[model samples]
Target: MTTPVLEARGLSRAFGHVLALDDADFEVYPGEVTALIGDNGAGKSTLVKALSGNLAVDSGEIKFAGEPIQLTSPTQASALGIETVYQDLALAPHLDPVQNMYLGRELMRGGLGGAVGLMNVNEMRSQSRVAFDELGATVRSLTTPVGSMSGGQRQAVAIARAVHWANKVVFLDEPTAALGVRQTKNVLETIRRVRDKGIAVVFISHSMPHVMEVSDRVQVLRLGHRAAVLDAKHTNMEELVGLMTGASTKGAA
Candidate 1:
């Protein structure tokens, strides 16, 4: 078996009197899509946050590439090549695609222009275009504010940005939520493209059809812990629902 690119063993987190995660175990391998499915308050968000360095775990171990590491901050996670796209799709409404792609990391020209704080707009635009094209994201106008773009287009930009910066794994939270049929199709296609490039994708959503349609494996969370992990091909919706609802504890091979 391939070593998991990201793994969490006995992960736990608490918020005041609430336990958001309780010994949650999870893993995602390279070049495959892993669906993270659970009902409300199942600890999916808490687990993702701990793995992505947005939130520290109360007790557990996170292994990356067979070595243990501390995820103290999102920047630390980014440095280790892990990226997350939250459900909110945190893109700047007033900025264009190219600008949004770079955000705080805009390339600056060398010498005088660099000292004068001039951004290398042309270079950034060229690379942003390549990233979008590589991800097959159709952004008709690269110069328009992303807020004005369609939902599908905005989602594409978010995924492309995450993939561009992430070399190992990318966590996507409810990527297709509230999207129309055509838009969801486009987003799912982009996800496949990302996986084909050898990055592990952690897809978290409540949509069973989408989970079955796009995932190679399904990891179900119940209450505050992982209920089971099953091969997507060998599992059915009823079984998944059973696991999530604690009606069944047996896991599929």
Candidate 2:
């Protein structure tokens, strides 16, 4: 069998007296969308923070591409080609799509200009356009501030930014939180496209219907522990909800 692109074994984390995650196990395969679904305070966010290197686990093992690794910070995770798109989208309200995409990692000009720390605006703009286009993002005017775009468009830009730099996996936390029906559909499509491109996608959401529709596999977190990992197609909503609420464990794959 082919090794998983990303895996976590016996992961645990705590905040003072509260045990956020307890011996959690997770895996994300290439070209697949693995949905991490659970109720609020079920350690979904904690696990995400740990995986994305925002929070350190008290005990666990993380392997990326079959190699053991440690991620102490978000910068370390990003350097390992792991990108995260949080619920807020994390775009500069005043900046345009191109500018937001190249926020911290800007291109520098060659020779004397590079030595002086001059940004290569033209190159950054061109590359951002290509990345957005590849993600099928609808940015009619790349020059307009991202704050002015619709919720769906902003979500698309955030996803594009992750996929642009992430060679390993993309962790999306509540990507379709407050959007309308149409906007939610658009964002979900973008997510599927991201997975189709052969990058592993860890989709964290509360919407069970959306999870069922988009995920190839579903990992249920209940009380900081993995209750079940089931095939998305074979599992029903009732089974998922039951597992999450500590009522059922019939389906564990």
Which candidate leads in TM-score?
1
Cα displacement (angstroms), candidate 2, residue 121, comes to 1.0
lDDT of each: 0.91, 0.89
Candidate 2 lDDT over 180-218, as tens digits, reads: 888788778888888988888999999999999999999
lDDT of 1 by residue, 128-194 (tens): 9999888778888899999999888899889889999999999999999978998788878878888
Candidate 1, which ten residues in sequence have the lowest lDDT sum? 244-253
The TM-score measured for candidate 2 stands at 0.95
Model 1 regions lying over 4 Å from their true place: 251-253
Model 1 TM-score is 0.96
